[model samples]
Target chain A: MSGIFNSSIGRKFAMALSALFLMFFLLQHFAINILSVFSPDAFNEASHFMGTFWAVQYILQPILIFGVIFHFVMGFILELKNNKARQISYAKNNGSANSSWMSRNMIWSGLAILAFMVLHFIDFWIPEMNTKYVLGDMSGMHNGEFRYFHELVEKFHSPIRVGAYVIAFVFLALHLLHGFSSAFQSIGANNKYTKSLQGFAKIYAIGIPLGFIFIALYHHLTGH
Target chain B: MNLTLKIWRQKNASDKGKMVDYQISDVSPDMSFLEMLDVLNDQIITKGEEPVAFDHDCREGICGMCSLYINGEAHGPDRGVTTCQLHMRKFKDGDTIYIEPFRAKAFPVIKDLVVDRSAFDRIQHAGGFISVNTSGNTQDANAIPIAKEAADTAMDAATCIGCGACVATCKNSSAMLFVGAKVSQYALLPQGQVEATDRVLNMVKQMDEEGFGNCTNTGACEVECPKGISLENIARMNSEYLKASLKG
Candidate 1:
């Protein structure tokens, strides 16, 4: 295991696997958020179902949290390790202006995303869980089920809250644009197909985040 | 043509360096880049001022001794040519050029523009040679019957003159492209395979020990390389390093 970490391929494999897992998680999260655009009631009900799913809450949530932590930690470690290995200085101006801005700003973008994630969880998940379980707010629902769903929509209706969501989604899109293509190359997947994959990744990165942004912006614009 | 030059001047490795400016006029456009510098030195000589010290031998690009950072670009503005091969025509009349020594922790500046790139020699010493004895009696050149593709690739890799341009152009100051080329040259040949694993591991270790930065695979080195060495060599080396680490 130590040898695996020591090897170049091993480090690359670790980066690729972690990035792929994160990409999958992004897709799932995006799908759930997109539901709000179509029907807020359905999205809230789904969110309530997800919160109450005992198997997912107990088993999968822990693993998902571990995956995110591992990905972030490993990325920092790899960048530092790479910094240590260099010897000579480039005599020319560094980094072409033509290169993708996301690639150049990956570390900063990732940091932004990480900060946003903390804010996002605090804004939605924690409050919803606290109101449901701790305070026992079962007042405004069809059944005695979680009314935390309706509360999520009401939170998004505020201009400041909607603005924060839009900002967070922008950072997420920036992170994914670089991370997606880089993950593939790190895994030794360079080919003609890699170019196409990069294009697709860029589109998905923009589209998914925009999907979430639309939900927040739409709610802020429309009353219900 | 008259021009102002700012050249880095350092007496020794421990000496603190500073850029000293000089003005030269009536420079011939046909003069090679080094010749123009020589002309400037001659003017400084008549005034009893110390000449700007720099490295050069065999003014041809092959020797790799004439390392320079001209106007923030390695080996000046020309692509696929060394500083020695660069001509005054590349510059216009009355232009100001900022020249400096190749700055890196590994390659310590010996004087104005010369650095002790013997670190690269040390890396080569670690594992860059074949163990086969060569007396007056040796196998015929064609005995191995190397495939043309392999032979071409080996030749391409062998073209790396150890100029340190790749290191200078890299963001992390990584020597991966240079080390990769050397490793690939040997790894692709039958004469080089018997000790391939040991060669790569030892070379890579020496490169790291020299305090070179890691490769980010940005391909800047390829763009600025005097010989246009491909980043594919780095990829090849990555593969070799993987195999060696796994096997060992």
Candidate 2:
């Protein structure tokens, strides 16, 4: 069992598995964020529930944090291992001739996502948690909602932050374009349905990230 | 056609190699890539210089011995061929070409354009075979029936020439495709069932021991492989390794 993760393919399997877990996590995140557009009260209720839910706080959040760390750390380590594998590089390498740009620059894409995550955590998760738990600032509680709708609206008010987010989502889209299909390929789940899955992957890869960018843009322009 | 060649030169395994230039004219377009190298060596020898030593046996593509990373692509710019099979026609007149050995820490440069690929032999020895009784008449070869789908896939895996193109083309210097081919060939057939568990476990361990890099599924190996070995073999190998892990 230990040997499985120690092998080359074994280690890659770990990376793919973690990336898939994170992908599922992002789907839920996007769904909740999109709710703020159609109905702010519903978004607030959902956010409050997520912020205070026992299972999410105690169990799922830890797993999510672990997943993010594992994905990036393993990715960094693999990049280093690969670099060491080739002590000498080609003087003229045309990486784009065969593979996609996202596939070849996964490390860079991942780094961009990582940097975005730190800013995101500061903007939302940190303040939200500090208010609810650390500072005990949950004064605006209703039936269950904490009236946290403006937090989403407030963050998008900054043009710089919104612009940074849009750019990050672009990288996110590029990352998913490769990551969605590649995660499936790494686990050996591909079959006759692979083409359709790749097609679906293309749509999802473009759709979700673009959806998030729209949410940010809507809040910024409307100031709602 | 006249051509300028920039070929890697190293005196020994540990020597710091550099690319040396040579110009040759009257090259026929029908000549093979290795044949062009032969012309270059012949010219160098007549000028009191040591002729470049490269590894080659069969001029055809099957042997997988003629390993060269040419113009940034493995086995030259042509697809589905080895260095031995690449022809001079791929280049135009007054063209400059660069030739270098397949670079991987595991593949040490032995001489000009020749790296030690015996590491492949060692990985194969680890667990690339099936156990069977051969001292006596083994049951009729056709007695045990295999699904045609399984047979075809197994044959596809078996076609890997072990040329190290996958390793060379891989950004990480990964040997997964090569190891995947060996693992999948045995895992697909009935003969390999007896020790399928240990076979995968042992082979993966051996591959890691050889200091090869990880597979990122860049698909360059399948693109450049002379035999057109599929990336499906790597996927299949992953499944086998996972299934083997569950047996514990």
Candidate 3:
């Protein structure tokens, strides 16, 4: 079973599986974040439960960390091998005929997403962990408002941060546009349903990232 | 027609190759692409110069012998045809065409416009066959009642001539399409059921040993394949591989 990771298709299969898992977590996190825009009390209630829950802390967080690390490390390794496969360059090469540019340049968007992920962790995840394990829940509390919601709104108050978030979401959208359906195709899920899968993936690729950007811009413009 | 050709030139596999330009005149539009090259070779020979060497046989296009990346497109600008079937009519007067060998880490240039494709043979030898008892007992082909769809798909996969154009056209030089076609063709047939597990596992392992890159789902192989092999075959191969791996 360990040999599976060494094969080309097998490596791609793992990449797709991890990507889909991360996407699921992203949607869950997005849903949680949107709650703050609606009501602070509701946001804090969910955040408190998420932070203190045993299953969420012990199992889910560790798996999420592994998934993220595997995705990044394997992605870079595969890109390196791909680069080594074609050493000499084509002088008059043309690319528009068969593949999308986004499919060809995944590493660029992926790197940008990695950069944003660090900041995202710093802004939310680290503080959540601190409150849950070491620091008390009152670390950043203000005026009886939820610390998580307050921290999120405060983070977006900086236009520079909001702008970076919006740009990272754009890169996320570009990465997902090719990554979504291609992940399914990579794992051999093709059939009559694949066309519909592609359609749904397109909507997902656009919608989720745009939703994130809207949330950031909404906070920046309207001071949510 | 008059054309300028920049053709890759090399003495042997170890020799460095460079594009050498040549002028050819009086080319007929009716000539096949190889025939146009034949005229150029004759001109070079008459001038007491070494003729450019390229791989080709069965100029009708089925043999998959002709391998060239012309004008940056594998097998020239035409779709679903090998270089032998490409006509000069697609090119125009005063055209400057670039001709080179297929580039891939697994495919080293053997000489001017010729690369060693024996890596494909090694990959095929790794699995591309079914195990059948040849001692006294033989099964009739008519005895196996295969569905029409399965038979058609097997034929579609069997059409790949192993020309290496897919490798040439691919950005990563991935041989997944070629390996996928071979694996799916056998997997689709009842006779292949006996060795399906080992066939996929060995062929895929051999493909990796050949140093081919990973498939990025670019769909370029299906586009440039002379046989018009479908990308769906790749998906089928992946399904077959996964099933086999899980069984282990």
**Clashing residue pairs found in predicted model 2:** none
Q: What is the lDDT of residue A70 in candidate 3?
A: 98
lDDT at B18 for candidate 2? 92
TM-score of chain B of each: 0.97, 0.98, 0.98
In the order shown, the candidates' DockQ scores are 0.31, 0.72, 0.69
What digit string (tens of lDDT, one per residue) describes model 1 on residues A1-224?
23656545456567677888878877887788777777767777777677767776678777788888988887687677656544333333535522356665666788888888888888876876676679885343646654654665688778887887788789889888777876765554555586689789989889988988887787678754
Candidates in order, interface RMSD in Å: 4.0, 1.3, 1.2
Candidate 3 ranges with C-alpha deviation above 4 Å = A138-141, B135-137
Docking class of 3: medium
Best by TM-score: 2
lDDT of 1 by residue, B33-112 (tens): 99999999999999998888888898888988887888877788888999999999999998998888776778788877
Q: Which regions of candidate 1 deviate over 4 angstroms?
A: A1-17, A39-67, A70-94, A97-104, A125-155, A158-179, A191-219, A222-224, B133-141, B145-147
The CA-based lDDT of model 2 is what? 0.88
Question: What order do you get sorting by DockQ, best first?
Answer: 2, 3, 1
Candidate 3: give the clashing pairs: none
Shares of reference contacts reproduced by the candidates, in order, are 0.23, 0.67, 0.67
Candidate 2 chain A, poorest ten consecutive residues by summed lDDT: A138-147
